[model samples]
Target: MSFADQADRTLEILALTPGWHRLRDLRPDCDDETVAAIVLEAANFAEGVLAPLNPVGDRLGARVVEGRVKTPQGFADAFRQYAEAGWLGMDVPEKFGGQAVPLTLHAACAPLFERGCVALMMAAGSTRAAAHLLAEVADQDTANEWVPKLATGEWAATICISEPEAGSDVGRLRTRAEQRDGEWVVTGQKIWISFGDHDMTSRIGHCLLARTNDQPGTRGISLFLVPNEIDGRSNGVSVDRIEEKMGLHGSPTCAMRFDGARGILLGKEGRGLPHLFTMIELMRLLTGCQGLGLASAAADVAEDYARERRQGGRPDQPPVPISSHPDVARQLHELRSTTEILRAAILELATTMDIARLEPQSGLDDFTGWMLPLIKNFGAETGFNVAGAAIQVLGGVGYTRDWPLEQYLRDARIMTIYEGTTGMQALDFLTRRLWRDEGRGLAIFLQKARDEIDAYATEHPGASEAALAALDEFERLSAGMISMRDDDPDGALYRADAYMRAAWSVVSVWMALRLSETNAVAGLAAQFAFHSARCA
Candidate 1:
């Protein structure tokens, strides 16, 4: 399906979600018609303005000239148009110069933008996420100063966590912030900083974590907002160099050096990691959107190619479209099924997160937390796998630069690695989400799935049966892993990947059942059943 089709399906799924009315009531301007229009406009902009830049950005990439990073040609202009269109602040609060629409709407629109040009969208995501982070954690004055700038895209931002010594082990970071003359100064070298240096915006801010005291590990780290320019002058922030990455060449991932750059502390001094999670969570969710965008695009390409490209047929007859072949047909069904189900799942999570924000006591937060890691990891995997599968369907032509599948494959490779590796997500799911949370989220998910199955069982017995069985298997596996938590934590960690796979299978079944209720995608429900069964 195309990105526009995905957006329309997202609206269908959103209306089907429980409590969607309540969410709609909260954001009156985000009613179904309004959101549909917004998404349609976004789709048009993404296709007309951003899609053309995808290949250009990949080919030209970003370059550094005289210490400043220059994004690929048209990137800066495209971002300007994007900002002017108010795309950056769709979900940000109106108080901070945003439209403050429901995140579900943003989620629906995001994949389209990502599909258009993920490389440029990297800068957009961080800026928007950082604006929300500041609105939540920074001091009123600090938020007032930065949030609007970010919301309007007058400036861009980066979440600086990884360093030479600290990648996933954030505790070992050596960046330091010192208080001097009633001002904070940060001194550090941060690597793997996306949009670390870009000409898309005049000012760039770093949501940096730096050691501030003698406390050990993460305890000593504090969050700081360090700008690249202060009072129209350089603030001692310099780009040492931009990495020559395998993909996403339009986004300049930089190795940055801060030589005592003036900084403002955000949130509590010792709660940097916890505070940063605000931004990290949103980015992780967006990573899933990124994956979905690429996967959808790949599916569209493969399906189109299969219908047009003809090859083998009976010797006595003329060649038929490859899509007529059983193998190609099956692959197309699986691809479409996986893509649509993942879209539903991501929208569900996004809606759940919206509900969690609206009603803190609703217990949806735990459920959202439970599903975040799964979506992040599997979402990334789906994009890469789908692109590879699409390449196969297109034969040798898909592997060549003439097609976008290869670029999509290369670009998607980082999603699994960056937000948190698949291993990291699995470990987090098993240890923190399942074990530490006491399976509250798991309980919520299981009950929810069972409710859906029971609701649809009479009409869709086949889908319900498959879903229930998968849910039962998932529950049993989860219990087994949880039981091992005390006696064999290491063993549980070892089984984390398996447990996560099972969770994805179960979730896929649930999503397939959800999609089965919709007329447009009902045919793919059986495909999901087969896919889930095989994966499980």
Candidate 2:
């Protein structure tokens, strides 16, 4: 299925969710036809405008000329068109110049755009997340001042957390902010900042974290909105240099310096890390969309190549399509199944997120928390792995610049590293979501899985068996890990990766059942079963 068709199916499923009525109450015009139209338009724009730029950006990249970072040709213009189309504010609140649509719709549209060009679409997530963050945390006046611009994409934003000394250890960041002469002055340097300096927008807002007091660790850190341009002049924020990355050259990964840059404090002092979680959570979710986009693209390319390329056959007969081979056919099936399952899982999480927002008492928030780490990590892995698999399917041509698979592979490499690494996600899942939260999320997920299995048991009895077994194994592993946490924290940590994989297997199974019910993708449940058995 095409991305648009997948998005349409995702919406249809989301509409069937329990609290979907609440979403309609929130947005009266959010009917199936309207939303699907929006998604279709977005998919068209992404394919026609954004996908073509993927290769251009990869080749030309963004460059610094005369101390200013200029994005590759057509980037600035494309961004302008993107902004004018109001995609930047698709999920932002209407009061802040956004459409205020359900996040489910946003999530549906995201993968389509990401599949078009992840490097360029990188600017969209942070900007939209920043708008939401400001709406939630910032004062009315501050939010009023910045959120609209971000929502409109007249300005772009970046989450500035990492520094030379801090990557995942955000508390180790040394950037300092102090009030002087009735204004906050930020002085420090941040590295590995995406789109830190870009020509796509005249102004770039750094949603920054800075040490504000003598308190230790994260307690001293505070969030600030530091703009690159203040009152149409420089704000003492300068780009030191842009990193030469292995991929995503289209998006600039910048090292930035702030020498007494004026900043406006966001939220409360000494609460930067917690407040930034608002943006971090959204970015993490979007990271999953990034992976889905790449995986979908790779799957499409490989499947197309397999159907057209003729190779092995009996010596007496003419050559047949490689897809006729059992081995290649198996690879294609696994790739499609995994990609589609991940898409369903990601979209389900997004729908749950919407429900959580509309009806917090539904207990779906914990479910979202439980699933975020899984989707974020696995989503990225699927993209990179699918791209590599596509390269293998295409033989030598895929490895060369002629095919987009190599570029997809290179661009996808960073997804696992950024937006919190896979290790960090696994630890978060094992430690906080499972252990500290007392397995509330796990309990919810288990119940949901049971309900799904029961609902489909009669029709898909054979399918339910594998999923049920996987579900049981996940519960056993999670319980054991939680039990071991106090006695051997290191042991628990060591098993975190295994625990995470088991959880993914469980969710994939559940999604496979859901997909099977739709009959949208044939044999996905069995494909998942085959893979689960292999892993077991």
Compare the candidates by TM-score and give the number of the best one.
1
Tens digits of per-residue lDDT for model 1, 283-364: 9999999999999999999999999998889989988999999999988877877887888899889888898898898989
What is candidate 1's CA lDDT for residue 356? 88
List the global CA lDDT of all models. 0.89, 0.87
Q: Which prediction has the highest lDDT against the true structure?
A: 1
CA displacement after TM-score superposition, residue 75 of candidate 1 (Å) = 0.6
User: Candidate 1 at residue 338, lDDT?
Assistant: 83
Off by over 4 Å in 2: 1-28, 517-536
Question: What TM-score goes with each of the models?
Answer: 0.97, 0.96
lDDT of 2 at 525: 60
lDDT of 2 by residue, 1-536 (tens): 56676566556656655445566776678887898789889888998889889999999999899988999999888888887898999888889888888888888888999999899998888888999999999989989988999988888999898999888998788999999999999999999999999998889999999999989889999999999988899999999999999999999999999999999999999999999999999999999999999999999899999999999899899999999999998888778878878888887788788878777788888989999999999999999999998899999999999889999999999999999999999999999999988999999999988886778888887778777877776677777898898889998898888778878877888877877755534346655555655543
